[model samples]
Target: MPGFSFETAERTHVGCVRKLNEDRVLSRPEVGLWAVADGMGGHQAGDLASSMIVDALSSIELLGTGYAFLDEVQESVQRVNRTLVSHARLSRPGTVIGSTLVALLIYDGHFACLWAGDSRVYLLRDGRLNQITRDHSMVQELIDSGALQRADAPYYGRSNVITRAVGVNDRLALDIASGPIQEGDVFLLCSDGLTGMMDDDEIEAVLKARTADDAADHLLKVTLDRGAKDNVSLVLVHVEPSVDDTLRTARRTLLA
Candidate 1:
């Protein structure tokens, strides 16, 4: 945030099979906060869960430090978890209201990704793509344990069964990964809707478009072309030096 700025490209759509889109996306470049949430439940209950999360996050204030920002975000999400859990308890038996959460936080030249369930965050640095968040799903576990092959995960029958999510359990556990952000680094936050339609290689190629906006649009269009079976949502964030920083670099080069 000090000498860097962010540009975001985002979209959310109801896929071919779904009538109502259960996915929600938040792109707050000014606050350096962005997220993608995919809700899971029948009869539009998914919408409620995803919307509640994005609404809660949409109002966060970046306080003292980067660490405080992280804490506030985690607390806000946990609060929503409690609220949803209570709501489900008050409803009929076997009523499940839950959603996956993947949030990208940037502050003072640093970045952090907080998530639960199968949604993902990826970083493309120096033209090389790497997935930042590991999925919390049955298929992922099987792949990790060597019971299933990485190439076969997309076709895994139990792919939809996630191990963690808000509203699914009273104690919502979010995993956090953090590091310093670099200029030209691009961060992608998306629901499984996109990943389900393409492998990492395919996604990496698409993200290599001339601009972040182009890459984001192309990603969505490609998913729809593949017969997106679930609600699709994604946010592509491009990092760059601020105007002042760029000027400073130019000045130094001229002086040299």
Candidate 2:
């Protein structure tokens, strides 16, 4: 990934029903970091929680790559977690302000996905679409436990319940997954607002678009068309070899 470059597109929509769009997206390809955070709707100051996450991640300065970069990201998220928890303690007894975080980090030739709650990171490679980050929602737990069928997940009554989040607990337990990055691989980071409106197949069809901008526009359009009931947000990143890297690859091929 060091020799490659990325093209990214991001979109946030309030949807048709929500009065406020409590979703935040960060796209910093320069730093090889991108994220999406969905504020828990109906909770106190959901928008504020999401914005704080974006601001925290924006402050990250890449001192090094790999685990060092990951450490910086994790610490920033944890710092925000502490802030939100302290603020809630000073507020009313039932006040809870939190947001789900899903961040994609690329460095060297590897990629890392860090997440808490249901925000997702997906990968599209070799014409196959794969969900890289697993959801921490009640519906997903039910499916995993065999208490609910995967097909019934959409209709599950407690679909909004999330087990892990950035600020709900004093010690935030973030989940991480890492793998090598492949040229031509495409990554998608999104809030549940987008997923709640569209299915994986519908998303795959949209991702098939030729450009990141087109894919983002078309995806948001479809969400609105389907009567989006929650705030929707997404960031699409396309990986391509840099010109110098491409020439080097070509030279290697010729030599071979």
Best by lDDT: 1
Q: Residue 211 deviation, candidate 2, in Å?
A: 1.1
Q: Which stretches of candidate 2 lie over 4 Å from their true place?
A: 41-44, 247-256
Can you give the lDDT of residue 223 in candidate 1?
94
Worst 10 residues of 2 by lDDT: 39-48
Winning model by TM-score: 1
At residue 206, candidate 1 shows an lDDT of 82
Q: Positional deviation of 101 in candidate 2, in angstroms? A: 0.4
- Cα error, residue 115 of model 2, in Å, equals 0.4
lDDT of 1 by residue, 41-136 (tens): 878788999999999999998688998999999999999999999999999988989999999999999999999999999999988999999999
As for model 2, its CA RMSD to the true structure in angstroms is 2.2
Model 2 agreement with the true structure over 1-256: per-residue lDDT tens digits: 3487899999998999989888999999999999999987355488989999999999888766599999999999999999999988998887889999999999988899999999999999987889999999888888998999999888888888999998888999999999999888899999888888889988887887668999999989988999998899999999888779889889999999
For every model shown, the clashing-pair count is: 0, 0
Model 2 TM-score on a 0 to 1 scale: 0.94
